[model samples]
Target: MTTNPTLVLGGTGKTGRRVAHRLADLDVPVRLGSRAGTPPFDWTDPAGWDPVLAGVGAVYLTYQPDLAAPGGAEVVAAFARRAAAHDVRRIVLLSGRGEPEAEHAEAAVRAAGVPCTVLRASWFQQNFSESHLVDPVRAGVVALPVGDVPEPFVDADDIADVAVAALSGDGHAGQLYELTGPRALTFAEAVAGIAAATGRDVRFTTVTTEAYAARLAAEGVPNAVAGLLTYLFTEVLDGRNAHVADGVEQVLGRPARDFAGYAAATAVTGVWKP
Candidate 1:
């Protein structure tokens, strides 16, 4: 295998980390682009960008927090400019489906004159095991503002697979992949799956957005995180992301992983236990 080093931005994060691992497994050289990596790359510090991009042929861009946050597009645009200046040839951006700001960031990458593939993804199934929802599930009750809205929560593994293919393989340039799971599930149903898989009495509680935010704040979650959660649950989870997409299969030539399978596998590890 040729050693075309790829820079994985947010390489320590949910999806980027997995992508980096997959690339490494295939004998591809990967440079982790995170504040903690050697020659650290901090999104808030533009000075850290050029060094990370140096000699990198392809980049997997996973913006921290989210690409939908305030000023995220500007930051992504600036990073793209720097990547181009550093002679980066390809960029695969991890984007959010249905987010206007994410679309703006995608446009910026496209304008950078490099080969770009946009993976516009839905919510991740790993949110329950690896993110904010983990503690709530461990506590036996997961509360949120979304009620009855279905979401095809894509697995992070599948996102990483698609990302690795786009970054390392051919025929993905100029493509926009809307990545989602094979099926959609409501929050209640999703929690029920977890309960069944883990043999734990986990419950899902629906509340108003304000109430959910207050609860999160009371739990010592930072204001920005709480606000972002509120926005995701109330605005993004309101039946807008209910349908499944074929981007995963389109990119990987295989069906995306199912959420129930993810829950079952994660349950065996006992990560949701208190």
Candidate 2:
């Protein structure tokens, strides 16, 4: 049994927190691997890695911002090496689909010589409720550069469940799971669904990628983050991630959650209420 406390990097984020909670519920000791965690694991500080890795048997890695971001693969490789040096045997990485950089990061994690499971997830359903779009949804307008191209937005809960299973159970090592919702929906359709669920007049506005990037800059968002979004909206969303995957069902013997279900559930929480 992999009974020791598993370290959950990005533990305060949506999927990470859910994984930590699920692990704790199973009576597994759960360590939040963040700068705020005991021994203080900071990705920006290489010196902090050893303290959190000590005595850890498994790790759930959710890179900040994105695994496809600049220099992300190198950082992942370094951290995986440190974990292997500390004798940590299991690793579950939260990754993205249709991303070349994400693939590179995955390879780096495997090169650490530890048994690993990769969850290459689609766009998250929680982006509307828990991330940048919350304010826009609440304000009744979600403007972005994405349009027409459909995405099967996977629920964070499914990702977390799969991560928990991979972390605690056998037979998941060397697995690569592509997790997505059962169906794809365009951004406008998604916003309409949210509006139906929340009884709001939320509108989805499509803008040019350049205009979106300029808006982000005007709003004082970091250039790196803005660039990531621009890349996602303009380049990555071009029908590459349009299909659904059964990774959640394959891993957990259960179907992945759908986007409408997510919006309906989130609606009841008043998160989209103005």
Candidate 3:
């Protein structure tokens, strides 16, 4: 296989880590783009751009925080320009499904003239075991501000496989993949699923966005982060994305992993043990 280094930005993150591992397993030269990576890269630091972009042919772009966050377009545009100038051929962006700002960011990458593939993934199933929900689940109460919105939470494993194919070949350029699981479930339903999988009493509690934000603030989370979380739960999870998408099938020629599958597998890790 002819190859050049593929940089996996946010290599320590959910999908990025999986992407990096998949690429490595395929014998692709993978450069991890993180603050602690060799020749570290930072989204906010322009001077560090050259070191990371140098000699890298393709990039798996996972923005810090998210593309829906403020200034996401500008940063994506800037990095795309740098990547283009450095002869980077392919840019696969991990974007948000149904987010306007995320689409704008994808445009920024395309505008730079590099072949780009947008993986617009829905809520991740790993967010429970891998993110803030872990402690809550172990504590037996997973409280959140979301109501009956049913999200088709996609698995990072499927995302990584599609990303690996996109990064290694020419088949997926300029394609926007809406990556979601085959079934949608409300937060409460998801919690129940996890509870059943882990054999524990992990409950889900719904709260107002304002109250959730206030709780976050009381926990020492910065105001900006708190507001962003509130905006995400209140504005984005408003039932617009309560359906399944076939991007995974389109790209991988296989069905996407279901949330129940994710819950079953993650339960084996004992992350929810208390």
Candidate 4:
């Protein structure tokens, strides 16, 4: 039988995947909580959840899509209740900074009668390196609705480190870490960094939110996802999240990773090449 296992939701996604790897490296038994796991866990299917939560002691909850979406808070609350019923002791929730809806979800986790830590993160640097923006970088141009508003894009590695620390170690409960890179940069500046590192000529183009949404729709992205992206760029990416936070240092006792470092390292992998 599996030992005292820590369940990692969204276990194949950006941060959760890294967290899982870090935990496994530390020789911790981990239960990957996703639709593809042994006992599948699907957010859309409540029946699929209990099986994964069974016998789990700790949880690293990374909500799919985002916690700011409709019904996200409720879903998290319900999941936390089930986790508590299953005797899970700790929960490390991956959250978004400056998102009111995300705050609601955090509160639900905190009130779940279990030890909870919220890793409230800004935009992820991996969003460019490993995500949708990778193609745009490889294509030599990244088009978005964001303007001069700078974002302190956090590295997913830093997020994963913090998450693993919280999930496996003590003294992290009831903490909320706002993880971000050490510097803030605009999309244009971020592209410039990637270009410098990869020896590529990547460009950034700004557009209206409507135009960005229209572009996503044309790409066959679901209307909800397209709208969420547009809302994130237009509403969340505003100057509200421009400043850098020390939550990473507060949690990890070290400075957060910088964006240039991420760019330099990812550049060596040739992931941005055309």
Q: TM-score each candidate.
A: 0.97, 0.98, 0.98, 0.97
Error of 1 at 172 (Å): 0.6
User: How well is each residue in 147-216 modelled by candidate 2, as lDDT tens digits?
Assistant: 7999999999999999999998889999999999999999999999999998879999998888888888
> What range of 10 consecutive residues in model 2 has the weakest lDDT sum?
1-10
52-100 per-residue lDDT for model 4 (tens digits): 9888989999987889888889999999998999999999999998899
Q: Which stretches of model 4 miss by more than 4 angstroms?
A: none
What lDDT would candidate 4 get against the real structure?
0.90
| Per-residue lDDT of candidate 3, residues 135-170 (tens digit) | 889999988999999999999899999999899877
* Clash totals, every prediction: 0, 0, 0, 0
Regions of candidate 3 where Cα sits further than 4 Å from its true position: none
lDDT score for residue 260 of model 1? 94
Ranking by lDDT: 2, 3, 4, 1
After TM-score superposition, the amount by which residue 73's alpha carbon in candidate 2 deviates from its true location, in angstroms, is 0.3
Find the 10 residues in a row with the least total lDDT in model 4. Answer: 1-10
Q: Candidate 1 residues 1-274, lDDT tens each?
A: 5566899988888998999999999989999998788789998899888888888889999887888888888999999999889888899999998888889989987898888999999999999999989999999999888889899999999999999998888998999999999999998999999999999899999888788877887889888777777877778876777889999998888999999999999999989989
Global lDDT scores for all candidate models: 0.90, 0.93, 0.91, 0.90
Candidates in order: C-alpha RMSD to true structure: 1.0, 0.9, 1.0, 1.4
Candidate 2: deviation at residue 48, Å? 0.3
lDDT over C-alpha atoms for residue 254 of model 3: 91
